[model samples]
Target chain A: MTYCIGLRLNHGLVFMSDTRTSAGVDNFATSKKMFTWSVPGERMITLMTAGNLATTQAVISLLEERSKTLEERDPSILREGTMFQVARLVGATLREVIDETTNEGQLKQDQFSASIIVGGQIKGGKPTVFLVYPQGNFIEITQDTPFFQIGETKYGKPILVRAYDPDMSFADAIKLLLVSFDSTVKSNLSVGLPFDFQVYEADSFAMGTTRRIDENDKIYQAISEGWGDALKDAFQHLPSYKL
Target chain B: MTYCIGLRLNHGLVFMSDTRTSAGVDNFATSKKMFTWSVPGERMITLMTAGNLATTQAVISLLEERSKTLEERDPSILREGTMFQVARLVGATLREVIDETTNEGQLKQDQFSASIIVGGQIKGGKPTVFLVYPQGNFIEITQDTPFFQIGETKYGKPILVRAYDPDMSFADAIKLLLVSFDSTVKSNLSVGLPFDFQVYEADSFAMGTTRRIDENDKIYQAISEGWGDALKDAFQHLPSYKL
Candidate 1:
């Protein structure tokens, strides 16, 4: 019921996520799924969530409370030593929320499960990304597999698998993610526009450009319409079958 | 899992199905999911299956036996009065198979459920397609929705939505489908090469070109490689985002 992408390029990390959340086909709302915490020059941690809204919001609120309460016993994601540690704390928080929510109910634990994509840089550590599972485990992005996608991922994946380039500019990367997200939005009703995106430069350790693309954004419209025309054109260029 | 598509065009109907069937990620084998029954100059019917292999194979075998036996009480698909009747018969047969399979033990009925895409033309009937559900019901393809895909369909759907044209030539349709299937095969291990395809021309009342495209097929290879390049080129043509 969501589509989120955390892509690691050679230059930096690019994150995009749809804002639509639905309890049923007829009930829908726009909710922000991207969260960020930065310490000026010390660290920058960006997290994108997909799955149960309550679990994700709880995890975010817990992390926020821990970070804001200077004397809290719980570790703060803001103060984590590295991106991996931040991912671990987020995973633990997700698991803790799911555990708490399901303990008093007859519902299955998976009903409240959520996954997170946590990525950023610590002052001395290299920029990277991790996909945190609902089980409180996570996997880091690698050279061979440089991106992570969660929820309603398949429709947009073919283009990403073909067009992703490690050394592309932030502008081009955004274009690629938009094309990917556009495919998903067109095919699935559960994922919609007003997408949130953030760009993190590799060594900056500070949050890069953060913006939201809504339905009327000129660039989004152009890409959405242009990509369809371009795909038809590209399809035509392929050699015809001899039947 | 399987991936099959049935597309209706102005000229006629096109069907393509992957041969891969898997019990799990590690257990896979090739199996034919496309079946055809033709009464020359009278009718031409093609059916594609996706879901439980046992149920599908049972339905196909039952259809074959009933059609072959001269005095069988059960109606044969080849003897149907209209394409709609043929689809109804297939749906009933599918439901029959699933019911019989699930009645013997503790296995859930859903475990034996299957879906079918049946399309063809009979005398005095227009070419059409129908998606037959597991409940012995179906809906015909309309002008607005000219195609049906079952199982592992999302990865390959965006291109079909963008590139499909009812008025296009059979060669173009095949090319379009090959591009769609190539996207699927590249992205999913459950859907792979050796795709089986059948083309039925309007008013032919007989089978059209039927073939299997394996890994070495030059055209498949060309499309598989060319589409990646074409997509990359198409992505490049989209305007870069202003970040």
Candidate 2:
């Protein structure tokens, strides 16, 4: 299980992913899920994946391999001209990799499953966010749904549904995202800390911010404590039935 | 889809459930998910159901029917001597009803498809809570896992995970339950307005307090709005990313 969120806001795009993977409860390990491909000012695409570790790793390896062999890879994401085209490229790569590995007659037979959040800007296009489904098909974020989340999403979904807005200030967006993540982490053992996050200013045409939030991070701590306190205070104010 | 939670606090027990059922996004209707079987001072039991409305309704009907039969029958929940006996009776009823309905049919069926939270106390026994699984087997709320939730539980699980404590005041417990319900209502279309809730006092052995919260309820509205604002304010107080 994983929790990754990609937000498309007026000020910028925010990408956050937890770094935890496991085959089972006792077999847990931390693995960074966020992958970024950048050609400096030309294009910067970020991918955060969730699902079967082997399948996710296979997909990432294939994409990274494509990035390295651009000449041989005709429709590579690195060479894509628009953000949409890049999504197509990523989807195609996902489909190809899932097919190659999960198809029958393979030594390690398993279900093909992986979902990715692709968010970035091409030199000539505006920054966009897309949620690629396990089937390799994708949906772009719209004004109504300005964010995309994949993996163990329910516990954290309420905050995003209630608070997210297309015109929300970047600060508010990030805070909401953190609270959302905090909710998920508290409930799920599969999603663990040392979060990977990046913020891209809408028209900056460059990566706006990137950092890893650990257990001791001040902001993360504040969000955790504040949310707990707010919930307690909120609970106190509700009308109680007089017994 | 539905969301129902049962909490076993030191002072008493709390049960809450939403009242919405849906086959899909297009087909939705309001259905009460909470039920009470009270003999006032002798015993007061509240049952909340979630999952497979047909199955839940069947179980409720059976329970209600049994309540009527207590006058004519030798053994029934109302006539039961102990809370444990009452729990056993409910479990046996659930098992019998599910097996009879699902086993005798040729229809494509979901096995033991409804989950229930049964909480109350007989006059002689201490207040108790049980989470009855679809299979008719059940688990008592313990000090370690003092609360049980069924139906669309994940959304409301986080607040409890962080804030619940054995010594938590009844006031705090009810507040927590409401906020948790609020989170669930916000996230899932399957869980909706008009919540039914009851709080039982430990030694009172009766339906101590109960309320039906609707969209127009002022206190609920305040908690919802205050929580959102407090979250934003808390977020503002946190230090921003330096980058």
Candidate 3:
């Protein structure tokens, strides 16, 4: 299980992902799920994956392996003219990986599958975010669902649903995301810390800010403590039933 | 879709449920998911259901029908010897109803399903809560996972994960639950307003507090607004990365 969020806001884009993966409760491991293909000032494409670690890693490897080829590498995440095309390339690669793996009778019942959050901008396009489904298709983050979450998404959805807005400040977006993640971690042991987060300023054409929030991070500590206190206070203030 | 929660606290128990049910985006209707069996001062039991309205209604009908025969029945919510027995009765009844309605020919992948939260106490028993699965088996809420949620649970889980404690006051438990419900209603269209809630005081052997919260309810509005603002405030306070 994993929890990854990509938010598109007036200020910019924020992507956060946890780094824990497990086939089951007893067989847990830590693996980084966020991969960046950045040409620095030219284009920056970030991909966060959830589901089937082997499958996701295989998809990433296949894409990287293809980009090294001469003919098949034209629409790479680094070479694509638009973020949409880059998403397509990633989707296509994911489909190809699943087909190859499954055709060999190595996987069963959608076990060799993955979902990716692909977000970035090329040299001439606006910043965009997309939730790439397991079947090699994708949906963009619209105004109504200004955010897209993948992997263990339900546990953190309420906060995003209530707090996310297209016009939110970047700072507020990050905090809401942290709280959302905190909620998920508490409820589910499958997702855990050292999260990778990247914030991009609108039209910056570069990664605006990237930080790794670890278990001992100060900001997270504050958010955790502050959120708990705030909730207790909020609960106390609600009107009780007249009994 | 629905959102129902049951909490077992040292002081008492809390149960809350939303009133919305939907077959799809277009076929939505409101039905109360909560039912109570109280013999004034002898025993008080609250049951909340989620999943497959037809199945849930069937289970409730069976329970109610059985309650009618309590004078001659061996095990009923009203006639059970202990809270544990009451839970077992509910689970066994759910199983029987499910089996009666479903057979091999009628089985689909998602057929014959409902989960219930049963909470309260008999005269000599302490407060207790159980999460009854669709299989007609159940698990009691413990200090570790002191709360049980059924249906549309993910959207409301963040708040509960952060705020729930075995030792929380009854008033605090109710407030926390409302906040959790508020979060769910904000996110999922399937779970909506006009909620039924009950809070039982330990040892009272009767319903302590019960109310219906609607769209325009003042406290509901307060928690909604207060939580939204608090989340934004907390988000804004987080330190941004220096890039």
Candidate 4:
């Protein structure tokens, strides 16, 4: 299992994803789930994936190969004219991988399925985000729903629902994502550290700050421990039930 | 779907369950998920159900009927010698109902399955909580893990993990539960208004205060609204991330 989130904020787009993958409970490994493709000052495309590791890796590899070899028949995610077309390319790649894997075996189709979050800005389009489903369909983020999450999402959702502000700063957005990720990591073993994150500034058409946060990252530790204490204090401030 | 929690605290046992049940997203109705049986000054037991409504209703009906008719060969839940025994009887009854329902049709066995949280005390034993599985097996809550949640459990769990204290007052316990239930209600359509809760005082061998909290209840409204504000404030207090 994995936990990943994509936020569409007034400032731009914020993306974060956990790095843990497992074949079973006992076999775990750290694998980066966030990918970026950028043509400086022209376009920036970022994607975070969750679900079957093989399928996600395949999708990313296909996108990477297509971008490098411009002569290929398949469209490259980086060459797409708009964020919407990039999402379609990613979705089609995900579906193609799942179909190929499922057809080669007697196993269930869902066993090799994956979902993705694709968000960024192209030269002419507004910065945006989309949630690509395993069925190859997708939905873009709107003002009514400014965020998208995939895999192991429910544990961290309450805070996101309560605290998200579209006008929040990139620093605050990262803080929010860390708190959300901390909640998920503490509650479930399947989603662990180090986390990969990328920030994009709207209309800049270039990736902004990007980093990997591990267990020892000083700020991550401070927020993780501080959030727990803050939550307890917050609970104390609520009016107590009577009778 | 449903959301029910059985919490073991030093003062006694606390149980809360949402009332919404649905056959499909478009069809929903209110149904009580919490039940209690007590012989004053001798024993008290509270049970909460989650899963297939038919199976849970049948299990509760069987327990209610067996208790009323002493001539039945099956042991009455009210007559169980200890809380553990009561849990076993409830689990067996649940398994019995699910087995009966599945065998009568060609449907999958899991379609008739249900889970339960049973807690309380009989004269000779300590007050405890048990999470009863669909297979007629149950596990009791212990000091290390003093709570049990059934159905739609993830969204409301982080706060419980962070704020629960065994020595907290009953007033605080109810407040904590309201916070938990409110989170579920806001996030899920399958769990909603009019929550039923029962509290028991250890060694009293009788049910304590029990109430149904609806959408319009004053304190419920206060806590539900106040919690969102409190959480947002808490997020502000956390140290902001730097990029």
Candidate 5:
């Protein structure tokens, strides 16, 4: 299992993903799920993968393998015209990998498949988030749906739905995501520490402030404990039910 | 889809459940998912159902039909000696209903199995809650596990995990539960009002406060609006992530 989220704010896009993957409860391992493909001043595309570990890694590796050509290949992500096009490229790669690896559709193959959140700024386009399905289709973020969450999303969703503001600062955006991820980590064993994160400021065309939040990051600790205490304090203030 | 929760506090028990049931997006109806049986000073039991509506309805109907005898008929719920025994009775009845309706297990039989949470005080015994599975097995709640949530539970779980206190007043317990339910209702259309709720104090051998909170209920409205504001306020007070 995995927990990943991407926020499309007025300032930029924020991405957060946990690194824990397990074949079963006993067989646990950590693998980075956040991948970045940037062309410096031109564009910076970020992706967070969830679902099948093998399929995600394979699709990402295939992209990296194709990306080394220096000149953008026929369907390379760097050569895409827009953020939507980049999502399409990633979706196609994911589909091809699953189709070649399994019989029937990947979703029906032992009921295992993968999904990705593709978000970034492409020179001429605005920063936005898109959730690409296993079937190679995608939907861009909208006002009503300002963010995209994949894998282990429900435990952390209420907070996002209530507090997300389109005009919030980049600092607030990442803090909001960390709170969401913290709730998920505490509730689910399959989602854990060393979360990879990055902020792609809109129009900057640069991947800025990338970091891995391990088990003992001081800021992460402060946010986790502070948020919990804040929730308790808030709960205390709510008017009690009329018995 | 339904969302029901039961909290086992040191002072008593609290039960809350949404009333909406939908077969498809187009077909929605309100059905009572919480039922109570009491022999006044002798005993009182509350049951909340979730899953296949038919299966749960059949199980509850069967238990009610047999309770009129005032004698422990074959496997009647009202005749159970302990809360654990009541859970076993409900589990076995649920299993019988499912087995009679399908070829395989309820879970595998068109995925129509039902689960239930049973809680109350049987005279001369301590108050407790038990969650009965579709397979006719059950487990009692304890100090480590202070609550049980069935059906669409994840969205409302983090709040419960972060703020639940066994020593809190009954007013606080139901307020906490209403906050949890409010979050679920806002995020999911499948789980909606009106909500049925009740509280049972330990050793009272009686049901305490009970109410059916509809969409226009004043307290429900206050809690719903108050919680959204409280959460946003809490989010603002959290330390921003230093990038």
Candidate 6:
């Protein structure tokens, strides 16, 4: 299980993901889910994955290798002209990796199935976010749906739906993502601390901000505690039913 | 789809459920999802149902018939000596309905499957809550797991986990439930307005308080507005990330 969110704002894009992976309740490990590829001022692409670690790692390795070679895969993340093209490239690579794993009997199709959130700034296109399904299909963020949440999504979705603003500052967007992640980590065992986050300002074609939030980060601690206290206070003041 | 919750607390029990039922996004109707039965001073049982409306209605009709007859079904809900017995009776009736529907070529087992939450007070026993599965198995709420949520529960769970207290007052419990329902209602189209809520005091063995919260109820409106405002204020005050 994992929780990753990508937000498409008017000014920039925000991406966040948890790092915990579990084969079962007893076997737990930490692995970064957020990956970034950039050609300096030309294009910067960020991808966050959720589901089987093996499938995601294999897909990432394949993409990295092809981008370096530029032989069979002509349109790599590095060379894609638009964000949509980058999404298509990632989706194709993921589909190929899943097909290979299924044919090898390494895992069932559903067992190794994974979803990815692709968000980036292409040299000529605006910053955008896309949610890539396990079946190699994807959809872009729209005005009605400005953010995409991939795994363990429901527990943290209400806040995002309620508080999201298209013109929110990068700092505010990061704060929103942290609050959303905090809600998920508290309720779900599979999603935990050490969340990776990134921000990309539109037209910059480079990563604007990046941070890894751990369990004991002072600001994260303050936000978590503050939100809990505020909720209790809000509850105390709610109008009670007249009996 | 539906959303219902049953909470067991040190002082009493709380049950709340929405009233909307839909087949796909087109066919929608309002129906009661909460039911109550009591022997006045001996016992009082409250039930909330979610899932196939036909199955829940049939199960409820069967229980009502048996309680009135009291001959063939000796341990009817009306005559159950313990809260557990009442839960068992409801579970068995629900299972029988599901099985009968399955045998009649009406629908598949999973298609008509339902879940129920039972909470009550018996003359000689403490107030308790039970979550009844479609297979006729049930689990009682304990100190570690003091609540049960059925159908469309995930969106509303984080707040309950963060704010629930075993010793909170009856009014506080009702407020908490309303908040949970509010969150679910905002995020989901299946659960809607006109929620039924009940409160039972410990060892009283009779219905304590009951209310149907509608779209225009004054207290319900106040709570909803207050909670939304409070959440926005909290969001505004959260410290922004420094990059």
Lowest lDDT 10-residue stretch of candidate 3 chain B: B234-243
Residue-wise lDDT of candidate 4 within B84-128, one digit each (tens)? 888888888888888887775554337788999999999989999
Pairs with backbone N, CA or C atoms under 3 Å apart (clashes), candidate 4: none
Candidate order by decreasing lDDT? 1, 4, 6, 5, 3, 2
Error of 3 at B243 (Å): 4.6
lDDT scores for all predictions?
0.90, 0.80, 0.81, 0.89, 0.87, 0.88
TM-scores, one per candidate: 0.95, 0.89, 0.90, 0.95, 0.95, 0.92
- What candidate 2 gets wrong by more than 4 Å, as runs, is A66-75, A100-111, A165-173, A234-243, B66-75, B103-112, B165-172
Clashing pairs in 5: none
Candidate achieving higher DockQ, 3 or 6? 6
Candidate 2 C-alpha error for residue A106, in Å: 16
Least well predicted 10-residue stretch by lDDT in candidate 4 chain B: B66-75
Candidate 4 runs further than 4 Å off = A66-75, A104-109, B66-75, B103-109
DockQ of each: 0.88, 0.45, 0.49, 0.81, 0.79, 0.70
Candidate 3: residue B185 Cα off by (Å): 0.7
Give candidate 1 regions above 4 Å deviation.
A66-75, A103-109, B66-75, B103-109
Q: Write the per-residue lDDT of candidate 2 for residues A109-222, one digit (tens) a residue.
A: 245578889999988788899998766789998888888899999899877876677777666666778888888988888899989888888666667678888999987897
Share of real contacts kept by model 5?
Answer: 0.80
Q: Model 5, A235: alpha-carbon shift in Å? A: 1.2
Give RMSD (Å) of candidate 4 vs. truth.
Answer: 2.4
Highest DockQ scorer: 1
Candidate 1, after superposition: displacement of residue B29 in Å? Answer: 0.9
Clashes of each: 0, 0, 0, 0, 0, 0
Question: lDDT, candidate 5, residue A82?
Answer: 92
Writing each residue's lDDT as its tens digit, candidate 3 over B136-162 gives 778998778888899888877777777
* lDDT score, candidate 3: 0.81
lDDT of 6 by residue, A88-129 (tens): 988888888788767565553488889999989887788888
User: What TM-score would chain B receive for each of the candidates shown?
Assistant: 0.94, 0.89, 0.91, 0.94, 0.93, 0.92
Fraction of native A-B contacts kept, per candidate: 0.93, 0.46, 0.53, 0.79, 0.80, 0.74
The clash number for model 5 is: 0
Which pairs clash in the backbone of model 3?
Answer: none
